[model samples]
Structures are given as C-alpha cells and as structure tokens.
Target: MRTDYPYDLAISDLREFLARRVTHSNVLSEFQEELDSSLKRKTVPMRFIFEKFIKYTNEHKQFVPYTKDEEDMIDDLFHFWG
Candidate 1:
C-alpha cells in the first residue's frame, strides 16, 4: 500500500539527506514553503508551525553540519522574531 503523507515523509527523509548535502539550502526552503501553504488553508497558528520547524531542525542537527558561524547567524535572526 502507498501513503498520502509524502510531504511529511520527504521532510523527514531530507533531514538525513541534508547531512551529506548541507550546501543544498533549496530543499529546506521548499519544505518551508509547503508547510506555509498547508497552514494557510487551516486554523493552525504561524507560531506553532515555526516552532515545529525549529524543533525538528534542532533535533536533527546531528545529521546536518551546522557551523558556529551559522548558529550565530540563526541566533541573530531569532532575536528579530518578536
């Protein structure tokens, strides 16, 4: 049998693939776009969606290489989230 949650599955799979292809930032942007589109058709809050991405990315960091400079850049961006 096949499944319909391909987007979700892709997100999970890509998290691992990204470990070897950290240079491919487009995949992350595509995932974010799909997530935003899904939320736009429902009652989900933006904050919740943002948190989900943040949490997943953090949890899977072991699979991806995040340099200290990149971490600092993220921290700076997070400061403006308010």
Candidate 2:
C-alpha cells in the first residue's frame, strides 16, 4: 500500500532530529561509572563498556531508540549512537 510519507526519508529525518536531543552529560557520567567499576574489578573490556553504554542509553531514553526497520540504516549512519 502507498503511504503519504516517504519511509526512508522519514527515518533519516527522525534520526537527525533526535541526534541533537541526546544528552551527552548523562551518557558520559554513566560511562565513567561503568569504567570505574570495571577498573576496580580489573577486567576492563572496552566492548563491555560500550555495550553497557548502549543499553543504558536505550533504557533511559537519553537517546531514543529506533524502530527495527530503521536499525540498519541508523546503525550505519550513527554506529547506534542511541
């Protein structure tokens, strides 16, 4: 079925619009806390830290999550910054 809005363009626009809305300070603080905990445990895995950051951001809506269809494109463009 045909739709009024263009799907690809809409996803792109939404991603761009939300990019500026993300709160960097909250992300940074969460990352720092994770890093400190990892350091104390003496098992500092960069991947783990990043994964936790992504999960935290997604959960807290610091950066809003995208829909499934938008996942690939958004990930390619922003490396899942959300």
Best by lDDT: 2
In the range 1-82, model 1's lDDT, one tens digit per residue, is 2223234443343344433433446656655565556445532223543465566666656346556754553343334321
Candidate 1 — what's its lDDT?
Answer: 0.45
The local distance difference test score of each candidate is 0.45, 0.49
TM-score of 2: 0.33
Candidate 2 local lDDT, 1-82, one digit each (tens): 1123333443444434334444576755555565456546644334554466567667776765567655654444343222
* Candidate 2 C-alpha error for residue 41, in Å: 0.6
Q: Least lDDT summed over 10 consecutive residues: which range in candidate 1? A: 1-10
- For every model shown, what is its TM-score relative to the native structure? 0.32, 0.33
- After superposition, candidate 2 runs with Cα above 4 Å error: 1-23, 52-82
